[model samples]
Target: MSHPPGLDLGQLRSHLDRERPGLVGGPLSGRLIEGGRSNLTYEISDGTSKWVVRRPPLGHVLATAHDMKREHRVIAGLHPTAVPVPEPLLLCEDEKVLGAPFYVMEFVEGTPYRTAAELAPLGAERTRAAVLGLVDTLVDLHAVDPAEVGLGDFGRPEGFLDRQLRRWGKQLDASRNRELAGIDALQSALGRSLPASPAPTIVHGDYRLDNVLIRQDETDGVDRIQAILDWEMSTLGDPLTDLGLLVMYSARLELPDSPISTTASAAGHPAPAELVERYAARSGRDVSAVSWYTAFAWFKLAVILEGIHYRYTLGQTVGAGFDRIGELVPVFIEHGLTTLKDPKNSQNSQNSQNSSEG
Candidate 1:
């Protein structure tokens, strides 16, 4: 019945041996995987076979944000496809075992390069190829038919964009601690300028280089995208929303002593425009509407950071980065406003929509 800070190793071992015996070789010991915010990931090693365990954060819960069953289902569904996802093993909903529900999956061996410095050893050419490969892999994911993957009803895609806007606005209200000047204007503009969405696909709610594990050859050139981690924000929605977030994260921010992980500033990494163009050519989706999506991505991230910052103020958050989170919230607000002002992207989106209608 005893539990560690996040997981109870003894209870977890008993549950695993009972439910999925022979999965664990011996007694279990685990270390928490750092750098993750929403879900707590632990590398559980039974001194022989290793696996990864995912569960919701300690206290605060965003209903859809850190779902164990949802993540498990999506990964299991994608296991038969060409998409790279860890093979899900067993899902345990019994809270008595670990104080919370959790799931186990095969451990992926690769590096999640978070900063420009981390990718530096790969050399510039390899870095470019690695990042472009990330785009290529994304195209593969969108190409998947939801019905084919047994995830047709994963989410209600009707009015997905409107739902996203309202959802984030509500999130902002929930965590509002002080005055943020341009945030409300930016939200209002987004509500007024919602673009007509295309057909829905499984959207990786947060897609960036760091969210994936990239395995490299001995030459250090990127080999393959080993696995796409963190499916908590994933659902069936506008695929362009994924691209927008990728592009937004592709641009380096000027946050001093930033706690956020970003690899956009790395040399040999393509610009946001290049990534958009590649996705358009490959996926054959309209790229014009992406600017609005990217702006919205900023707003969503700002609200999320504010939530963390609010939790930090209340002493609910753990780890080193929470202290600097509030400092980055307003910066995200300003960037969202600036991104919306760019007529080239937003106007092009509207024009593209009008053309399609005509």
Candidate 2:
């Protein structure tokens, strides 16, 4: 049997049998799971048991972007919390086993709901509940005390907003291959109008509907988030950044045959404002500065998408839908600019007022 690229069943079974002992009952069979644009994820089965494996993608990897240890650590820390995260099983840092550092976790059963069509079957009410649940779950995640969870040192939270802007700017520079209009302007605008971050908590760097597993409970027929996946970008940072990223994804991208997967167009999908209001009410954090954060989210995603597009050009990526990633970067940059300049942006207007008063 041909194992998926970046994974060897023989070495995996040997390592598991040695370290975990008796975890592997029968032969291992695995296949790569789709929809992940950064890390390479595979679903592995040992005839009786199933699990998921995660590792960095092949070639031209950005520094500190795909750390298996970091992802495993965050999930392990958040597993005990009310935050829905997959249970981490084993972490193998020894590259001899998988040819790269990798981690294993219990296979979570649920739908990621990438497109509106995927969510349409649940009806409007069910979709609304699921989306609201997304916000509530986020509140639950931000509510966790990082020190209590032993994640106090997960990331440097001091000056997080500025550092985040600089970090993403550097990432953008690293992936630069061609002229991207408005990207630099967006970066500069975000730096100029940085918002005051609340006390730092564990931030799910990429919190969106598609990054979580949603399963409808058979007994109650209520869609529930089973486990949150893809923690590669998680860290101890401004919690509002997560909310910002969520809000960015909540906005509809009007594009025909868009490469980016989004459920914002789904029937009954709550407005971004509703999600923000719910989060503010539940988390008790002032969201008045959310517009700036949302604009920053757009800029960050544009950089990330450009990085992916760069990787695709280098033939380093290992998935479909990458061919069109370049097309979305400009749109995201435009949104970032528009978000900051919009008269409805209370954050920007407030900042301007404060500056003038001072």
lDDT of 2 at 193: 85
Could you give candidate 1's per-residue lDDT for residues 219-319 as a string of tens digits? Answer: 75446899999998889999999998998887768565678888765667776777788899999998777878989999999999999999999998788
Error of 1 at 97 (Å): 1.6
Across residues 1-358, which tens digit of lDDT does each residue of candidate 2 receive? 7889888999998988888998889999999998895899999998889999999987635638889999999888889989899999999999788878899999999999889889888877888899899999999999999988789899999999999899899999999999999899989888888888899999988899998899989999999999988888888999999998888887878788897888877778877777788899999999888888999999999998999999999997766689999999999999889888882652233333322322
Question: Alpha-carbon error at 56 in model 2, in Å?
Answer: 1.8
- What is the Cα-based lDDT of residue 193 in candidate 1? 94
Q: How displaced is residue 58 in candidate 1, in Å?
A: 2.5
Query: Which residue ranges in model 2 land beyond 4 Å of their true spot?
Result: 59-63, 177-179, 310-323, 343-358
Q: How big is the positional error of residue 64 in model 1, measured in Å on the Cα after superposition?
A: 4.4
What TM-score fits each model?
Answer: 0.91, 0.91
